[model samples]
Target: MKLVLTQFKIELLRIFRNPYYVFWSLAMPIVFYFIFTRVISTGATDAVAWNKHYLMSMTSFSVMGSAIMTLGIRLVQERSQGWSTFMRITPLPGAIFFLGKMFGQMIMHLSSIICIFLAGYLISGVTMPVHLWIYCGLWILIASLPFLAVGTLVGCMKRVDTASGVSNALYLVMAILGGMWMPIDILPKLMQAIGKWLPSYRFGNGAWELVQGNPPKWEDILVLAGYFIVFMLISLYTRRRQEAI
Candidate 1:
């Protein structure tokens, strides 16, 4: 437990040291949210309908993108430097390393949520059910874990450049099809059908529901849990094979 916390602290410092995150992770979504709010708030009804759900979902996208893409790229870079191999030979338990990373991803989502909530509160008078905010925030974090695990497999299990290329390309494809760029309503039926399969789709919908003061349906949790299990198994199997080699 102590080792895990230590690793998590170190990983978090590395993430913050990037500096670029202050804009992309912290400020960009707030800017986008207010811009969208301004465009949509042309009337009284629109204002009435306006709340944190829309903004929160946007934050969710920001978290999903950052956790999957940024973390994925970092994982590959670290692996390429033989960091994973070195860790494997060290006193650090491999599970602790993965857990620390997963916790860092969760912390990233929490930070995004806080920034967006503050932006919405200050500018739009957007309010939320406090308990639901906590609830929904947790689900958003839960939904992201599998994608982080996916990054673990791709970045650590394969060549760094290939993993980076594949992860980014796949993120873009999933973002469009999964309605991260826009509401799923605007997507084609076939695309929406496919969105059901992508982790981000459920994340968006679950976040939307949470902001609306609704508990997530069981299936949202189920889908994310399933992905977590599947991806972790893949990563674990590959790690064992690498050891065998």
Candidate 2:
């Protein structure tokens, strides 16, 4: 237990030390929220609804980005630099290491959710009931598990540069296609169909519905769960293959 706690602390410190966590996870989303809500569509019809909707969008966006880009790239670096091998040889139990890292990243995701929610409240004057706020935040954090699995899969890459590029591209493509950047309704009909199936869109859709006093659809929950199972299976396969080399 003590070793797990220590490893958790180390993971938190390591994550905070990465400038990308601050810039990409924290700062960029807030800036995008400000620009989209304040600058681009200051005159949006039903400004309150737009603000709330976009708040959920950006919060989901930040958490997803951190899960894929931050976690994935870091894992690749550790493996390439032989840190993963060193850890494997340590006395620390594998489950303990996994728990610590996963819990630490959960903290990171929670922080991003809080910061973006704060920006929505302070900067955009978006208001919601306390329960609704808590519900939406919790939903985003929970729905982000599949993306973390994607990160683990990306971690299987042997090269940091390759992982970095792949993760970045994956992050951007998912964000854009999933309707995190803009409303899926405005996109072409074909694109809208595709976005609805994407885990990213399903991720934000649940939170968006929550803020609007609707429960997330069963389809959304099922889709996310399916992706989580598939990604974790693939990640496990890749990791075992790497170990055999």
Predicted candidate 2 versus true structure: per-residue lDDT over 37-57, tens digit per residue: 988864668889999999999
Spell out the clash pairs found in candidate 2. Answer: none
Clashes (candidate 1) = 0
What's each prediction's clash count? 0, 0
Candidate 1 — which residues are off by over 4 angstroms? 40-45, 48-51
User: What lDDT score goes with residue 8 in model 2?
Assistant: 93
As a TM-score, model 2 comes out at 0.97
Displacement of residue 30 (Cα, Å) in model 2 is 0.5
lDDT values of the candidates? 0.75, 0.91
TM-score of each: 0.87, 0.97
Deviation (Å) of 36 in candidate 1? 1.8
Tens-digit lDDT track for model 1 on 100-124? 8877777877888777777778877
